[model samples]
Target: MKEISCALRFMFSAEFWAMGLCWTVSLLASYWQLVLRRITGRCEVYPRSELPRNLPTRPVCIVTGATSGLGAAAASALSKEGFSVVLVGLSSELLSEAMEEIRKRNKDAHLKGFVVDLSSFCSILEFKSSLEKWLTDSDMHSSIQLLINNAGILATSVRPTPEGYDQMMGTNYIGAFFLTKLLLPLLKTSPVGSRIVNVTSFTHRAVFDAQINEDIVTGKCFFRSKEYPYARVYQYSKLCLLLFTYELHRQLNLDNKPWQVSVLAADPGMVKTNIMQEVPFSLSNIAYLVFRVLGLLQSPENGINSILDAALAPSHVSGAYFFGGEGRTLRSSALSYNTRLGEKLWNISSNMFFDLKLASQATSSSS
Candidate 1:
């Protein structure tokens, strides 16, 4: 009875209306830009070639969230390009499905699948250890050429990751940051022009300065489902990702020992994905109507064009944000470049993972 009463009260409260209004405005602002691009005929689709390459050696492309949606699309496309694509998903079964999907597109697709739950620190560390051993065993002939941090979620519930952080923030930003940091040494050994593409969104602009804090990661800010602003939380996660993208890009080129690797961000503006399914039926239904009515949602293939360009286009510069196709680029939110906020976020996030490094070592030794 109490739970029901609380839900009912929240549904009728001013907070609920305020949240809806904010989401509606953000959605319009973000999608309208894409709509204008489409109207101006600036969005052109990238084509794929199916021929398998017989090169002496191939570079590896690691794409997370490979089981479905844009991630799976990216994995398949990279495989077609003759890169030895390493597909990362949350489970072995999902990885198998992704590999199978890729092979269906190109029977000769060079692909490998690995399971790494981004929301779990132990899982990430274990996967890193396994990948390191694999690279060593394989004689280091094929180093990672590209990494796409594509796995993300828009969580409506107050679910905590295995590491007790907000699941969305953990998966969308921290997990990507951790995985990229762990792989930096390997990436340094990669081909001279290796690249890292951290996927971000325009929705990041929705998060204001005051909302950017450690509480976002500590899970205190989004602890209650009834009052949780799902759309804003999604924006918060993307904002953190954009900040990481900028800081990492800056750090990589710092101190005169510039890494050959290029770090960039891609915004696939309003793609159709399973992320919205987690929202309540009322909200999801409204979003669906808006998507259909405004022609705002795009297919995974159409959406990944920006991502593919970021990954494959040699002309791209590091720290650039690919906002749309046809070589379009845009400055991300002004707040995304706030160096102080970026440094603070970097320190906190790095410390969070560093704090877990000891625990991970202990657990592995025990096992």
Candidate 2:
């Protein structure tokens, strides 16, 4: 009877409670640092006078998915900084609304809108042509200074694009890849040098499969069935973007060009955006709600802060992955640094684009 009483006392002892408290505190700290703080969005504001003055007097900054959210916020901010901003989106109405909001912030803002569905490679090609013509007509071909690949989508299911690739993969990574490649000429010609900021996500570390990556880029993979998780697909798309950023940076170095064109991946953390609108009543939704209530989700303005930093980064800042409101450079996933995987992915993507161009040409000739 005495032993039993002693055991019970030990179970409820101060030492036991102290140990438990320590564990709880440690867990909460880890969660806050790794998950919450990373996504909560923080920013350090630089006064207008401190803005990078090395750029052209009327530098050009192109922002994709600028109809709303981080892209819109970035466009408004850049315009206020005296950049001639080009807004890209899928809807003319949304583009006009975004432009109006930006102009309201900076009435002298030089903003132009282009409506192009990024989910479609053909549309990106059309946009590229139209953008080049506009640049030439405006005599601003040499003024291109920044490209923000901010457009992305989250799919609840695997829908195939018109080009027969997964919708999320096509829009988030492949389209951005092609668009940047197509605009390389203007970017390389920039007098103030250029920067390409690919808006990635921390989710890239969540789901990364090399085989799956190859399959998605080669158009041999589809998740239309319920077997694959749509959230994983989104993570994979971001992983592809990170890989592309690193690979592009490496290629730029290999080309040995004196003109600086830095490519960087920016993880915006967990911004309150429409990207997750497709997520149903899942654990993700629950977590999002908790984050919102806790005020851990970042605003669009705070979310794009890293992207702005990457865009204005110095020449030596190429190929780095930046995060949070601080815009501190951090090591990405192990796979992100795998040179072999990056090279393979780059080759596969280039081949896929080549095939797409050939197919388009064939269709046009047949027509």
Best by TM-score: 1
Q: Which 10 consecutive positions of candidate 2 have the poorest summed lDDT?
A: 42-51
TM-scores, one per candidate:
0.85, 0.82
Candidate 2 lDDT tens digits, 211-288: 535676633466535344455566778888888899899899887773378898887777777776654334345556
lDDT of 1: 0.76
Candidate 1, which segments miss by more than 4 Å at Cα? Answer: 1-56, 140-142, 210-212, 224-226, 255-259, 281-286, 363-367
Q: Any runs in candidate 2 off by more than 4 Å, and if so which?
A: 1-57, 212-214, 218-220, 281-285, 293-295, 364-367
Global lDDT of each model?
0.76, 0.75
The local lDDT score (0 to 100) that residue 347 gets in candidate 1 is 91
Tens digit of per-residue lDDT, candidate 1, span 1-367: 6645645664776655655566556657755655676788754333322322332467778999988889998888888777888889888988998788778779989887888999888888887788877777776544577889999987756788888888888899889989988887777776555789998887787777735567776566677555666666777788888888889889988836564777888888767777666545555566667776877668899888888877865523678777666556666778989999888888988888788997877877999
Candidate RMSDs in Å, in order, are 4.2, 10.4
